[model samples]
Target: MDHTAADDISHQANAWFALFHGGAPTPEQRAAWSAWMAADVRHAQAYAELENLWAASALLLQPSPAAAPVAPARLSRRRFVGLGLAASAAAVTAGAGTLWLNGVDSPFADLRTAVGERRIAYLPDGSTVEMAGHTAMNLDFSATRRAVELLHGQAFFRVRPSAAGEFSINTQAGRLHTREGEFCVSCENDAGLVAVSQGRVQVLTAGQQTELEEGLSLSFSARATGDIQRAELAQMLAWRNGRLVFFNEPLLTVVDALQRWRKGRIFIMDKQLAARRVSLILNLDHPDQMLDVLSRALAVRTTRYTDLVTLIYPA
Candidate 1:
């Protein structure tokens, strides 16, 4: 293996993935990445390889690895992850590279689903949580209380009767209180929407409270809570079964939901175009064709820059 040459390109590919995954990137950065990929066929291949690497890691979301099968030394779960990423680094020992990743573990043992991934985690008390893609949350269970915080993204909670005192999802907007219920909460950009699929839950926002039974949803933001709306969330769960259902949903909202099950970013350069409405069913198995369906229907053109970024604008 020619170490020196491929190392620079692979590291650049990973850096581009990190930049695109972070908060919105400026036009210059996007253009630079585009040009970088266009410079050499190898650059494009390196990026494509990275995207496939992420898509192939669905197994990691299965359950926390008891222990890495390869390395002889003991390794914590987080360090193991950094060690995997280190495999793509230039010329360095994985052990030395992961020293920093070890000290950076979340205080409360945060669980997350990467882009294009979903996770099912069974809690200590028999309760289960289903996390949507690009989601992150933390669990803090004690004898007196059981609570999980949705730092970002969406999660479905299946509360167990004998779990503890109370099972609730805490957010900056407010608290979603439930007991022995099946509910979903999606929190993003300082707001959230809660829906009940079974049993009951209460949405406590600000000083007011709203009780929700099966087949109801409440949308709340950091500032105020909206009226209880009828949300067929069970349909949205189609991702679990390799399908996504959309009915008269805003184009931006649809894109946001679908983006979770895919790698990279979808930039709606035209804000007005983002407001267009879409109604369709997308197959999760072939995530790429999702953009195809919308592009043809809305007469909007989708220009995909490899697998790392997609651009949607009026055709």
Candidate 2:
């Protein structure tokens, strides 16, 4: 292939790499990418080259020994552009480190779901857990205890009645213990919310213990806990039905919830806009259209820099 042709193929491969790494692509996007890959053998080659470049760039970021500082490598125009794109991808991944179990990879999770995906896990002890998108957790079961550490994101758990011991969920905010119950727990921003729908839950935080009964919910952080409120189960567990119900919630809160069900990142450029309260019901079946609907409802402007980044600002 000619120089120009090869550069064009490389650029196309970079675009595909960005889209796939940005978040979980929709079925249509995946199909289109597959078709592109199959159309020409050169396409596959270009993609492989991009992957190799990225791997090398990652190695460059590591600290070197004290022997000597190596000279920087010179770059051609095409290589420079490829490296720039790789850097942006790296930045996005780093920015989302907290969401991915505080920099821990999903491969280390015993149970996990990708962006825009939900999963139901049936445990060895007959308990079941419904995991939300981008959620990760680790399970440790023994004869003396049934323990689960929620690394991040959210989950709805149904604990099976067992004489083995109390089922416990540990999170950054606190710990919850119960023998048998149905409840939802969401961990975000170094805090957590626990809503019980059945049975009872005992929450331990900051050297204090609080018990919650059915229909009650509590929010806790590393330092303190919020007042227990009557949980609106239908609204709290709406994600289970493929829906999001926000009632007078801040725009920031709504954005955070939407981020779980979709790929890419959404930023509110204005603090005023982020603090604005809104109420709406959105269906998760069409996550791509959510930002448009939200912008239209709130009279805001939404701009898409790429398939991976979006900015929301005042109209």
Candidate 3:
């Protein structure tokens, strides 16, 4: 099959998997799903891959007997499926390989934050890093160079002025170089974002280079670069102040941000609802109210299957 056909099948498989995984399906829904599964051999294959991936992830993330007692929660199925899709995309080339390791738990990450947790790190060179919840990054510093590779999630960097060399941040999408500035970098949905709060920084991606001054922001991916646009510095950096600000942003984006600050998973099962635009500011201090707030704001209903799993749909 061609790439587009493969992607369509994958998406359909994921949607069906999510419907069944969220909770017990209605008889009609189950019948529909069964028909879909029986319609194509490739559908069964894709879904089987999802099941295997989920089983492996379950084993990998399972807490040991010695682990402290905590409220019951499961890893996000949505995230696992996303990982599978990404790996599949990378494996499109013949002879390519894929590794299904979680970035936040990877051994190579020098620093990481847990769900609903934030941390500040002071580097040897006097630079400061403020990591958001669920963020992970690796540090490579030497006498000649200072570098950080953001494996996933988000972090704000304040580079200490240095004549030695420019501090660099590496994300899957691109690289950012800066000196004597404060900026934030976020990696989400296969894209990287850089928003400058102070001083100037340079972004390089897809064989193109762009310079961003204070109050400017840009987003890039492996294959494309975005235009520099003026940014709302306060809103963009609100997480540092224990807030999340969204202005006419998609529900999918908001849900992704909320996932970082809370335990467990939040899934928008309805594609139309996920694409709905939202504008709101939320306090990160009270993550427990997230679902209720979203339900109220968007006129949706939230069903909690387990302490860890919450699914959103039209009211």
Provide the global lDDT of candidate 3 against the true structure.
Answer: 0.74
lDDT for 231 (candidate 3): 61
Candidate 1 lDDT over residue span 33-143, tens digit each:
999999999999977865664443333223335644232245566765564454345232111111221222233447887666678999877899998776778888887
Q: Estimate every model's Cα lDDT from 0 to 1.
A: 0.69, 0.77, 0.74
RMSD of every candidate to native, in Å, equals 20.0, 18.8, 18.1
> 108-195, model 2: which lDDT tens digit per residue?
8899888778889998789999998888899999777799999888999999988778999999899999999999999975699999
Error of 3 at 214 (Å): 1.1
For residues 1-315, what per-residue lDDT tens digits would candidate 3 score against the true structure?
Answer: 998798678657756765575457899998998898899999999888767754543343334477564443454788756644553454221110212123244455789887778999998789999999888888888888899889888898999986659998888898899888999999854588899879999999878999999878998998999888766565577688786767568887888788788775566666777788986666677787666666756788877645545667789
Stronger candidate by lDDT (2 vs 3)? 2
Q: Where does candidate 1 stray beyond 4 Å?
A: 1-109
- Candidate 3, which segments miss by more than 4 Å at Cα? 1-104
Cα RMSD for candidate 1? 20.0
State model 2's lDDT.
0.77
**Candidate number achieving the greatest lDDT relative to the actual structure:** 2
Off by over 4 Å in 2: 1-105
